[model samples]
Target chain A: MALGLALALLALVLALVLAVAWRGTGLALGPADWAAVRFSLVQAGLSALVSTVLAIPVARALARRRFPGRGALITLMGAPFLLPAVVAVLGLLAIFGRSGLLNRGLEALGLPTVSIYGLHGVVLAHVFLNLPLAVRMILQGWLAIPSERLRLAGSLGFGPSEVFRHLEAPMLREVLPGALVVIMVVCLTSFAVVLTLGGGPAATTIELAIYQAVRFDFDLGRAAGLAGVQLAIGGVAALAAWGLYRPTGFGAGLDRRLEVAAPAGWRLWGDGLVLGAVTLFLTLPLLAVLLRGLPGLAELPAQVLPAALRSVLVALVSTVIATALALTLALESARRPRGLIEAAVTLPLATSGLVLGTGLFLLVQPLATPMVLALPVTVLVNTALSLPYLYRVLLPETRALQADYGRLAESLSLSGWSRLRWLVLPRLARPLGFGAGLAAALSMGDLGVIALFAGEGQATLPLVVGQLAGAYRMEAAAAAALLLVTLSFALFWAFDAGGRRAAA
Target chain B: MLQLDHLTHAQGDFRLTADWSANPGDRIAVIGPSGAGKSTLLAVIAGFLAPTGGAVRWKGHDLGPVAPGQRPVTILFQDQNLFPHLTVAQNLGLGLRPDLRLSPAEQARVEEALARVGLAGLGQRKPAQLSGGQAGRAALARALLRARPVLLLDEPFAALGPALRAEMLALVREVADQTGALVLMVTHDPEDARALGGETVFVGDGRANPPVETGTLLANPPQALQDYLGRK
Candidate 1:
C-alpha cells in the first residue's frame, strides 16, 4: 500500500510533465527557442566531450598512482557534484569572472583578459561541475582492470601502449558512452549554472529559455512550447542515457586501491599535470568563493535569516518526502522486482526541472497564485528531483541486505515489520542517513522550480542570491552564497557524520 | 523421522536429487565433491530452496508449506554466522526472539545459552571482538537456544583451524545431544564425516543417496565417493 502511494505519486508527476508538455494544440518552435535548443546541445556535447577526454589521463593516473591523500582526493571527487549549482557558479565566477583571479593572473602575465561569461564560461562551469564525475567514472574503469590482467601484460612483455590497447582502452570504450550520455543529459537540464554564467542571449540553453518564457515573457503558450522542446530533448536523451547508464563503481568496495605499473618518463609528467590542473580547476573557484565571501559575512543582510529558515524547512520536509518515497519504492521494487517502478522513480533525473516546475505551474496557476503554491511546489519538485540520489544511495545497500541476510532473516522467522526492524532497518541505517542527507542538501540549495513558482518576495536562498547578484550587490551576494554553501554542507556533514557514527 | 521424499532441484545445468530419512538424534554427514548436491539437499530440507518434486516431512507432517524460520530446522553457513555490527548477546537473542525483545526471563535464557556454548563472559562483545571459534560458539549458542528439531551445518567452521573445527563439532555434538535434534552437516573432509559418525549420505552425480553407517560407507565407498576422496 505504501509502495503504491509512492509509485502513484511518481507516475502522476511524470504524467503531469508529459501532459503539460503535450497539452497545447500546436507545436511551434521559434527562432529564439530553436537557438536555445541548439546551444543546449552544443554546450552539453562540448562539455561531455572535454570532461571525458580529459578524465582518461586523470583516471589512469589515479588508478596506478597510490600517493598520500589519494583516498581523500577520491572522496572529494564526489563532493563537486553535491555542490549546489548556484554556489558552484559563484565559486567559478570568483575565479573566472571579469575581475576574478584568472583574469588578474593573465593581467599580471601581460596576456589578454578572458571573460567568464557567454558560451565558453557556460562550458567551463559545466566541465567544472562534470569533470570530477567523469574522472571518477573513468578511474573506476582503470581500477577495474584486474591486477591479474596487468600482471599478464607485464609477463607477456607488453609495454604501456600495448597494455592500454589490450586492457585499458576496451574498458574505457565500455564505460565512456555511458559517462558521455549521463554528463550530456546532466548538462542539458542544467539551470543554475547556465542561468548564472551564460549571461547573454546567444548562450541561452533550452532550460534557460523555459525560465525566460515563463519569467520574462509570462507567455504560457511560449513557455509550454519551449517546455515541450526541453521535454522532448530531455526525455529522448534521458531514455537513451538510462539504457546506457551503469554507474562506474568508483569508491565502492575495498579493492579500489590496486597496484599497477604507471607509465614512465613524460607520460608520468603528463598524468601528473592532468591531476594537478584538474585539482586546481576544481579547488581554486571554491577557494575564491570562500575568500571573497568571508569578509562580507559579518554584515549579512537582515533578509538572510528568514529565507535560510524557510529554505531549511523546505529542505528538511522535502528530504523526508524524498527519503520516504525512495525507501518505499526501493524496498517494493527490491521485493517484487519491477523494472517499470524503478524507471519511474528515476525518470525525473532526465526531465528538465524548469519543465517540471512549469508543468506544476500550468496545473496550479489557475486555482492558486504561484507564490502561495511556491514553497509546496518547490518541496514537491525537489523531492522528485532528489529521489534519484536517494535511490542511488539506498538501493544497493537494501538489495545487498536482501542478498546476504534475507534468507537468514526468513529462516529466523523474521517477517514483515520484525524483519524490517531487526534486520533491514538496522543494516540500512548508514545508507538511509546518507540518502536523507543528500536529499536535504540538494533541496536546501535547489534553485530549480522555485524560479518559476516563486512569486515576488517568495525567493529561496539561491533565488535571493541570484537577485542580489543581478542587482550588483556583490558583497552581500557573496556572503549570502557562503551562507547557503555552509548551511547545505553542514546539513550533509551532520547526517553523513551521524550515519558513520551509528554504523561504527 | 526427518524425511527428504524424492526431492529434486534443478537450476540451469545443475540438478540435485535426494531421498533420505533420519530418526531423532541421528548425526548425518552429507559428503560430496565441491560442486555436487550436498548443500542443495540441506537447502531444500531447510526451506531455502523449493524442491522440484516431493516434500520434506518431519514426524509425519509435511514441511513443504513451512517458512524457513518456522520449520523444525536451524542451518548455519561456513561463516558470517553472526552480523558483525551486533553484540554477541543480540545475535544470540535473535534465535530466542526474532525481534530481540527479550523479557527478563528470556534474557536470562539468552545468557544461559551463551554460557552453554563456552561464551559466558563474551555476550556483551560484538562479533568482531570475538575470535573465530568464539564466533562459531555464538552461532551454536543461537542454534541451541532455538532448539530446532534439525540442525543443518554447511561447513560452518570450515575456515577454522583443524583443532577449532574439532572443538566446534564437539560442541555441536553436545548441543544436538541436549536438543535431540537431527544434525545434518555438509563437509568435504572425510575426517569430519568420520568424526560426526552415525550415518553418512554421499552426494554426487546429481543425487543424494540414503544414509548408511559412516564407518561402513567410508570403508566401502561408491565409485563417485572414492574418486572424490582420492582426488581430495
Candidate 2:
C-alpha cells in the first residue's frame, strides 16, 4: 500500500510535468520569461552564498562556546523554519522599510537611508529565512569533529589559525558545498518570499511570473511555460542537492556538549561579537514583529479572522495527509530500503508548490471553476510540498523500529493495525509527532499555492498578510502576520508536545 | 514430525542444505562456525526465508503457505525480545492477542506467565527498567504464554552472564517440556550444546548434517567440526 501510494505520488507529479510540457509546447519563450529565469538563478545564488558565508563565524562561535542559553539559542534557530514567510517579510520591513526604524535612525544621523526593495530586499528575506538553517548545518559539521581530534590539536599546541587550517577548514570544505547547494535549491523555487518582496520585470522569479501570468494576464500557455521552466530548474537543483546532501547529524549534539579549544583574549571578544550580532540579526526582526503587531492585534481587519481559520483548516487537513503519506512511505521503505521509494518520497522537493498548483489549475480549469477548488488544491499542494521533510524525519525512526523489533512483532502474529498500534506507533511516536508538527506548521505558514488558487473569499492567512502588505497596510499586515505565526506555532507545539508526552 | 525435506537455501554467495526430520518434542542444538548458515536454517523452518529447492512440513502437511506469525513457531532473537516502550505485562499480553485487547482471563494468564518466569511483580515495569536477567525472563514469560509447537532460539540469552544464561536455558527447557514443543537452539558454544543436553546438528561447510547424539558427536567429531571447535 505504501509503495502504491509512493508510485501514485510519482505518477501524479510526472503527469503534471507532462501536462505542463504538453500545454507549453507551442508557446515561444519571451524576454520576460528568460529574465525571470535569470533573476531566479542570481537571487538564489546570492542568497545561498550570503547565508552560508555569514553562517561560518556564527556556527564556529556556537560550536566552541558553552554558555547559558546557548542551547536555547540553538533551539531558537529552528524557530524561523516555522515562522511564516509573510510574517518574516513584515518583520524585515518594520526594521528596514522607508519610514521604519533603520531609516529613521539613519535620517536622525543625517545619513543616506537604505531602501529595502528590489534584488537586495529579496535576498535579505531569503537570508533571514535560511541563515538559521545554514548555521545549524555548519554547526553540525563543527560538532561532528571528534573531541579526541580537538584534544589532539590542543596537545599539539595548535593555535586558532592552525586549528582553522587543519581541523575547521577541512570540515568546512566537506560540508559547505552541500549546505550551499541545499540552500540554493530551497531559494530557487521560492514563491512566497518572491511574491511579496520581489516583483516587477527585473526582479521577477519564474514562480512569481507564473503567478502573474495566471492571475493578472490570464495567460495559461505562458503560465505553463513558466511552470515548465520552474520544474526543470527546481528538479535539477533538488536532485543536485539530494546528491550532495549528508545528514549533518543536526540534533545529536544539543546535549553532548563539546569542549574545543577556546582561545582567550581578542578571540573571546570576537566570538562574543559574532554571537551577539547574529542573535540581534535573528531576534531583532522577530522583536519588531511582536512590537509592531501587538497594538494592531485588537483591531485586525475583518478578513483576517476568517483567513486565519481557513489557514488552520488547510494546515490540519494537509498535516493529516502528509503525515499519513510519510508514515506509509517511511514504513514501506524502511522494511524494504528501496531507492525508488526514496525517489518517490523526495519527488515533492523537485516539484514546487506553484508548479503543482499551476498544473492542478490547468487540470481543474476545464472541469470547473478553479476558484472553487482553491482550498482543496491548497491542501493537496501543501501535502505534496511537506511530504519529503516529514518522510525524512520519519524514515530513520521507522528503520530503527523495524530493525529492532520487526521480527519479534512478526513472530507474535502482529500485523496490520495490530502491529501499528502495539509496536510501530509507540516506538515511533516521537518522530511521528515531530514530523507532523513540522508538516502542520509548514502548511499553516505556506503562502505559495494558496496565492495561485485563492480568490477573495478563500484566502488563507498568509495570503491575507501578503495582500495587506501589498496594499501597504503595514499595521494590519503585521497584526495578521502575528496571528498567522501564532497559529502556526500553536499547531506545532500541540503536535510536538503531544508526541513527546505519548512517547514518555 | 517437523521435516526439512531436502531443504536448500542460498543468500548471496552463501548456501546451505538440510534434508532431515525431527520428531515431536525433540530438543535439538544447532552449532556451527560463524557465517555457516546456522540462523538461516532456523529462518527457513520458521518461514522467514523460503527454501530455494525444498519444503518444510509439519505433521504430514506442507507448511509452505504459512505466514511467519501463523506458523506454530516462536523465535527468540539475541536481544530485543521485548518492546522497550511497553510494560512487561503489555509485552507479554501481546502473545495472547496481537492487538492487546486482553480479556480479564487473558490478563490473568499474562500475570501467571510472569510469575512462572520469576518476574511476578515486575509486570508494570517497562522493558528499559528491567535488568538483563529480568528482561530475558520477561521474554521467556511471553514465549510461555504463546505456547507454540516450535520454538527457535537464535542465541536469545547469549548476552546473559554464565549463571543467568544457564538459568534461562533451564527455564526454556522447562517451558518446552510443559508445552510439549520442539526446540531448535542456535549456539556457538559446545558447552551450551551440552547444557541444552539434546541431539546436536553440526551445521558447517554449507551443509547441516543429520542429528547426532550430543555425547557421541563431541566424543568423535568430524575433522571440520574438530577444526571449528579447536579454532574458536
Best by DockQ: 2
Task: Write down the RMSD of all candidates, one decimal each.
Answer: 3.1, 1.6
Off by over 4 Å in 2: A248-250, A255-259
Candidate 2 residue lDDT tens string, B78-124: 88888888899999998999988999999999989999989889999
Error of 1 at A120 (Å): 1.8
Colliding residue pairs in candidate 1: A411-B69
Instruction: Show the colliding residue pairs in model 2.
Output: none
Give the runs in model 1 whose Cα sits over 4 Å from its true position.
A1-6, A60-75, A101-115, A148-171, A199-201, A246-276, A332-336, B219-232
lDDT of 1 at A360: 83
lDDT of 2 at A253: 55
**Lowest summed-lDDT stretch of 10 residues in model 2 chain A?**
A248-257
